[model samples]
Target: MDVIKKKHWWQSDQLKWSVIGLLGLLVGYLVVLMYVQGEYLFAIMTLILSSAGLYIFANRKTYAWRYVYPGLAGMGLFVLFPLVCTIAIAFTNYSSTNQLTFERAQQVLMDRSYQAGKTYNFGLYPTGDEWQLALTDGEMGKHYLSDAFSFGGEQKLQLKETDALPGGERANLRIITQNRLALNQITAVLPDESKVIMSSLRQFSGTRPLYTLADDGLLTNNQSGVKYRQITIAVIISRSTPTEAGVMKNSVLVIPLLSARKTLRASLPTKGSRSLFSLSSSGPWSFRSSLWC
Candidate 1:
């Protein structure tokens, strides 16, 4: 009979420590990245999990990892991450009135300040790597200008003073007005970058503030004559004006700051399916049979 010797857990100490070291490095890297990306909640969670993993592997008696690690990873990725994100989003003012961040709003205001009161009928002419605008003001004949597309800031076009249209063909240019929504949409497309504002091809009246923020943090709605005070960064408490008595009784509506009050309605089950509560950001809640009907 051949005698067999069993190797103790200490014999594999090298392998255990190696695995723990690797895990620590990974978790540390993730925590740093998350913290820098404005995800403090995630970074804290990673730190906690990494500490637990390290402790489990470092000890000889903690066989809990065989069951703990898989569950921890699953819950961290799915349940915990989503829960953290939801909590973070709940605290932000994301409504229409305060839609843009302070930084973005500042940029937009700066860009709007540079508009000149000049309108022109222009046609788009495609160049090799750029687009040229063939513009005519009243009966002032025609002028050609080439432009570079900028993500943010003013669209400053260089007047091709000496160069005329290719073959002098005026029909090649297509007249198009600048879309204001396109400038705002760029933030949605590339949120990390500065907001872009494209100069309009036609001159128009300037924009005015519908509401202004006071030094004490009160926002006054010029149109509705209502005033809103910021209770928290995410929540604003607004008092209704005398004129809005019919639509919004003596009620309060909690709304998302990034969204417009006029454009959204939400349905919630306060009691049961038989009784449905319909709510809008701008008005009082009502109980209805069906949200659609």
Candidate 2:
């Protein structure tokens, strides 16, 4: 009598190799993508985890661990990580002050520059095969020229205001569109250290930072000279659940974050400095964590 044999998923060596190769390529692509997005820490972590996972899945000796790893990774990434972050953030102002984090606020301030003084007009001038940038404050002002820059290809723009711009053969619509993205990244510094950036396709202007952050958690308004000092506020969490007799009021932590009044009008809660945790005023129960000055 002939006996029947069982067929397994990895019975074919070619299939196993193909799967492994595909997974390696996918992991490499994801790692490179994360790196390009400036998520260096996450990229490293992903690389390490992917290497270990591949090793465990491919090796017979660690076959048991292969089954365990997926669950553990899922629990770590999906459950534990979010739980930990949420718990940690509950003690602080994670979503306070118009839900703006410190880093995000800094980026907003950094990008809040405005054109000041005389603005310059920008256009591309031909330089052999490539193109050099030309900037002029007026028709007769000292024309600032930039070195020939290449974008939409291997090389990128590193334009300098020290470089001169002159009227000649201008770049066509095709070339301008090709280099438009790279042009946006270009910021040229003048001899006086003032920055000039392209505001539009044919417009270049002087730009100045509106705010700056200091080492000691101080945010300074460069235009108004207002300094915002970081301070801590106590979070009083009251569990309104009726236990055996009364509700439990648990005080978590003293959170330190943004608590400032800007000149611009916004739809945000009124700024308060009441952070002593000693609530002398009568108010309703609030779950919103405080980051008062």
Best by TM-score: 2
**Native-referenced Cα lDDT, model 1:** 0.48
Ten contiguous residues minimizing lDDT sum, candidate 2: 259-268
lDDT (tens digit, per residue) of candidate 2 on 157-243: 444544344648677768767778887777766656666777777777866777676787666667766555443332212222334
* Steric clashes per prediction: 5, 6
Tens digit of per-residue lDDT, candidate 1, span 1-293 = 99888878766768777877888888988888776554667788779877876787677688867578868877987898899878766766544544565445433433433332334445445455444544444454545444534334434344443235544333231333343443333211111221222345342222335666777867665556677654333344465333454443223324433232232222223444322223444333311122221
After TM-score superposition, what is the CA distance of residue 47 in candidate 1 from its true location, in Å? Answer: 1.4
Give me the candidate number with maximum lDDT. 2
| TM-score of candidate 2 against the unseen true structure | 0.39
